[model samples]
Target: MRHDASRRRFLTIALVTAATAPIALRAASAEAAAPAALPKLPATDAAAKALAYTENAAAVKHAAFKAGSSCTNCNFFKGAKGQAYGPCTLFPKNTVAAKGWCSAWAKKL
Candidate 1:
């Protein structure tokens, strides 16, 4: 009876570990493979300069810039609503501040 109980307990442990091992391994691999966050676009970048991009919309002086405009409200901005910084269509590889502005700013609607 004692030997039978030991064998059953060992078998149960081995089965449980085998069932959960793949799931644990997959979760670890996915975490490791996750991409890092994108870099922020600098206001001084050549492309940014051409568009008159500014980190703060209030400081924009371009003729095309309108009062109360910013990346959060622009058509080219792809950031989620309320995000402080996010990716922009114009600067594909970099994120922009939600309050940033540029000549290309257009109504999201």
Candidate 2:
């Protein structure tokens, strides 16, 4: 009875591991294969002006623009690995320039 219990426990562990291993591996690979970073948005875009966006944060003219803040360092930036442009939560379906700045920029935690 002892041997039977041990064998059953081992089989259960093995089955569970086998079932979950593929899922774990697939998730890892999917992360590795994600799309490259998006293109930088034009500073002249209407939306850019509305948000007081600037390719260079230091160049922003808005009274609320902070001198040292930039999109690359903002919480809203979702840049991909090694790229200068990425999607911003503030601008759905549009990319923000990495060096850009906006009034909505928030320091990434």
The prediction achieving the highest TM-score against the true structure is 1
- Give per-candidate clash totals: 0, 0
Point out the worst 10-residue segment of candidate 1 by lDDT: 58-67
Q: After superposition, which runs of candidate 2 have C-alpha atoms over 4 Å from their true positions?
A: 1-37, 80-82
Summarize candidate 1's per-residue lDDT along 6-104 as a digit string, tens digits: 999999999999999999999999999987899999867899989888889988778898889999999999999989999999998899999999999
TM-score, candidate 1, is: 0.67
**Per-residue alpha-carbon lDDT of candidate 2 for residues 13-45, written as tens digits (9 for 90 to 100):** 999999999999999999999977545677677
Each candidate structure's TM-score, on Cα atoms with residue i matched to residue i, is 0.67, 0.59
> Local error of candidate 1 at 38, Å?
0.6
